[model samples]
Target: MSRGLLFRLVAIVVVSLVFPLAFTAYGLYSGARVERLALEERERQMQRVLGEVSAGLREINSGGKNGDALDREVRGVLNRTLAGYPGIRGGVFLPETQRTVIGGELKWYDYRPEVWPKEGRELFRERDPVIREALDTGEAVTRRIVMYRGEGLVHALPVTVGGEKAVAWAEEVLQPAIGQDRVLRKWAFLLTTMGFLVALASALYISGSLGRGVNRIKNGLEQLKRDLSYRLPPMPGELGQIVAAINQLAQGLMEKERLEEQLQRSARLAALGHLTAGVAHEMRNPLGIIRGTAQIMAQEYNHVPGLAEDVAVILEQADRQNRVIRELLDFARPAPPLMQEINLNAILESVLSFSRKFLEQNQVNLVTQLSPDLPQVQADGEKIKQVFLNLLLNAVEAMPTGGTITIETLATPDGVAVSFGDTGPGISPEARSHLFDPFYTTKSDGTGLGLAICHQIVTMHGGNIEVETGDRGSVFRVSLPRSPERRDAGGTLDPGD
Candidate 1:
């Protein structure tokens, strides 16, 4: 399976964390190794210096030397040996008399001039432990200590001085690598901490961003399950592309479902057309004959009061039946429209003028918002007027007591549009679905062919009729193309085709 965004995000975080840790580990390891090696080399150098001083002390000639001469000779040996090494100082400690002797010319000594001991007994008292350890053990003892001039190494070796036990000790200031290593360790720790924190912050930020994007996608998918019309919002990088693809897929699915519904509607309408044609042919002749007979009887029996009333009822019923037949025929085989360029606003104004008295009688207030720059469309003015009139009457009937009907004409991208909005109880979802279907009417006395015919006429003219309804009211919009292409020699266009 392909890796998901979660996996990629985790991988990114892991890699981000690993790099700094690896770098820190390597830095610490390399730094410690270098520091250790430098320290070991310094210790070796101090050992060599101490070894040379020890040999030089053994070579000192004290056959007839008095105490002052021996002291001067030993001081000369220490100064000569220590002078050979920069930043090195040496001293001898006699555990028997507790006397310490330091080279006077060695400026690298830890003590200041004021702190320097004038009494030999008080000098090098701190070295007593190390010197005694070396004299007792009869072996060299070495120690590393921090001094005034950085880190230094001190070595004490047991020796026989004037046939008495003593400790010859040497001290040397280590190379500056020891101090540099300390600084390096401090900086490395600080830098590693900072790097780790930065990595953690970056990981959290990236993960949060990715998580939000993924959550959006997830929520979008859930919405799609409930509503195919739902579209994914814009995102960045590859996520944006994914959202675009998903939106396209949703659009395609909606189109496919729309086409399927249209196909079903077309098939049903075709069957109804065939049935309507047969029924209208059968009922038309009978309806005409009945009306003719009723008219003759009424003329002959007017002097008979009750007879005339009965004949009038028969004539009215016949006329109503004939109108029904006529409607069916019109629906079954409608004549093609005479397509021409016409202003929709002019047609709407004409329809409004013709229907004003009827609307006033029904107690409906009329409102108009016709766009001055509305475009003309290719349509039949008379048929378009009929459609608008039917919609207006339907709106008036919807509000039984009284309501407002707003008529609007506006310019669309491809053509002109006219809408009729009415303040009445809206069409239900179930009724709305079949509003344009044959013989489906909400009115008690309606033939249910008015809006269906309107839909058919508009469709023939390469136009569309749509409705939007809510609890507040309903709005019916008719959109006609500016220049519709004639589909056949008869100038008829089938929207489905």
Candidate 2:
């Protein structure tokens, strides 16, 4: 089945069983929780009300508390309570006599003095155990068959009524005619219906999504196996994240494939360089022999030596070829660096200062535009210095007659930025691309390892280096991230917009 249909099926089954069962169960449990909390709150409220009542009644009955003023307050309690729970059926207030002092018009009610339950003969009592416990503990006592037509809760409290300490008791009973329980049940049903619909919708969404996700992953993997180049296109919501992960995985695979291809190409290049080196070595011996033999022949046949100049030229050209081969071998492999944190600014200043005299003699003005708050980037300063020096040397060499060399420090969002511009001849578009290649150079006498080593240095420092050739001259830009910031950097150099 399709995931959307299966989800709907599961939801239908769950909804069929859960709603009626939970609703009925809730009806049984809700009343108990409410009753417990409400009953406790009611008991606390009653205790507070009765304390003042006891004190006032005592004063009124004995002329001891508040000088008869308490009598009015005692009457107020009777009047207020009748208004509060009018269905209270009625109660009696007694100060001295054990007889009930019924409230206004209370005698006409079925609730009478005869209805108050009392202990029988043979009971060892100053008062009934239930009343005594309630009075002594200052707590309510619940007893069976003690009051009118339901569960009755009684509280007995001590008072100084009629200048003698007496006990006052009060009772309340829960009646079934209020219809509150029915209203409560109706709300409970309505709440259950709403909750059921919400949960059903959520579950439907989740189940369908889960099934769809699993299918997408399965299909994606099948496609990936057949075509490793396949990419996971973006989707909506969390499935978008799944697609992102798939894309990331696909990208990683692609990078690995690219690395493998590079390695294969490197192997091919290594073989070719080795073969060329061997051929050069073999030719070196023969060329040396031929040059030596030709020189000897020219010396001996000087009388008929029209061919001496050509042989000498051949010898010189062979010497030049030998030198080029030697350079190529040297550049084929480079040594690992002694890496350490060193200031590039210091290195640049030192190298430029050292080369300053030679540059000035040739009318080449060396400009220093170091950053005021240039951060100390971690790098092998010696290697980086060699790179800057080589570029400078190359620029001077390129600008044979004379020109201006502008060196500047820059701060970039990506990292620390450095730029070098020379008023040398502009590089051709073709030669600029291969400028950093091992044996690539525009100058005939140049070794060509200079820019290549410079590239290696900047890359090792986790920075990038690039060159821009324009109408003026060539510019090399370097970017590097400043080291992790410290707690409170003292006046940081912000890369202001």
Candidate 3:
């Protein structure tokens, strides 16, 4: 979810950044387009100016004046019209004889090298095709004129002065429009860069804040898992509501656990009563044999052969009764634990070492993932070791053939957790509830006090033991409270305090 949030934030930021850049690009395009239209309109105005100059020449020609007078009138029209336009570089009136009739400069070449009066024939034949076409067809034609020094729009119109074919042409410069476009591009680039950086910084800040909020919620959830009594602190908005809901869930779980414990206690008492009656009945037969054997031995000592055989039977039955009594007593009342700071990993290793040969003989593979940095737990070393040993033995027994037993450890907010998993047929739901009951056993020879003792030991150490079973196998998890220095910030196992 956090990843999705980050991606969306980044997507929004990218879109935010792209918009300004795209807008700037559009502005540049629109500006260039407008500039182009304006330049074209200016060229049209220049063409119109040339038209007026051409019309004046035609009017003067209509008078039928001969030689110098008509030439002077056309020359006056060209110079007077050219003076009115700032963009007009120069102009020339080329007569059919390749002579410059009206050159804007005093000397024809003084105006410009590529100006029509200095190189009119070459301009028509090579550079300006539309000009040549206009001269041949006796019509007005326009073309773009580019020289080494500059470029412009050119218009050429065919005319007859005193019955001689002539060409009149004008040029308009475009350097100003090109320079404006360069300036506009630079501004657009600068604006885009600054906008993108601002958007990136803002996105990073917003996304980072969101990530931290999600991490806080995650940490709160872990706290709830590690300590059932823990409640989330107040948070703003929907997050606050989530915290309240989780607290309610914890309360519900606590209530369920309390009720389950009461039910388990009732069930254990009923089972214990039944087991006690059976044990009592079993002990009576052994006790009767011992009593009868003692009386017979006293009456027939040294008088009966093989009387030792009878004595051996009596001793064996006595030992058997003693073992049953001892098991019953241990289950009925367990001794207080001798607490010490012990590493759970070391205890697990010790249990594994003891069971390594047994596992190998039974073809059971063992896997351990003990944390090297696990903190020492304030627990009874022998008792915790016994707990692990019992669980390991049970896992090995669960697998009749070759299988795996995996032991792993992880640090929790309130403590450390160790898990024992067996790849064997899982416990049925009916049997699962009675797995930890004293005197209950799935095995024919088992006294059924092993896991029951383990549960008791872990409970005494201020920890818990839980079991999960499925089709694949079963897992037993033991959560032992950490030492004072390693406990959660809000909790400590300081008996002195």
Q: What is the C-alpha lDDT profile of model 3 across 237-309, one tens digit per residue? A: 7777887888899899978975687466545544564566466557767787776777678577957787767
Cand. 2 Cα-lDDT: 0.61
In candidate 3 the C-alpha lDDT for residue 495 amounts to 20
Name the best candidate (by lDDT).
1
- Please give, for residues 1-497, the per-residue lDDT of candidate 1 as tens digits: 12355567657766776776677778778887887787677667667777776777777766777656666666777778888877667776655445556763343343233456453224344455777789889998887766544666777877666656667777666677767767877787788777777766776676677778888998999999877778999998988999999999999998898667656667777777777788788888888888888888888877876987788789888888888888777777777777778898888889888789989999999999999998778888998988999899899999999899999988989998889999999998779878987789877889998888888788777777888888989999998889876542121222221
Clashes of 1: 0
**TM-score computed on alpha carbons, candidate 1:** 0.64
How high is the CA lDDT of each candidate model? 0.77, 0.61, 0.72
Cα lDDT of candidate 1 equals: 0.77
lDDT of 2 by residue, 144-228 (tens): 2344333544545665555654455444554453235746676777776777777777777777777777677778879887666
Off by over 4 Å in 1: 1-175, 182-199, 222-230, 258-263, 289-318, 360-365, 397-404, 423-433, 468-473, 488-497
- The TM-score, computed over Cα atoms with residue i paired to residue i, of candidate 2 is 0.36
Model 1 — which ten-residue stretch has the worst lDDT? 488-497
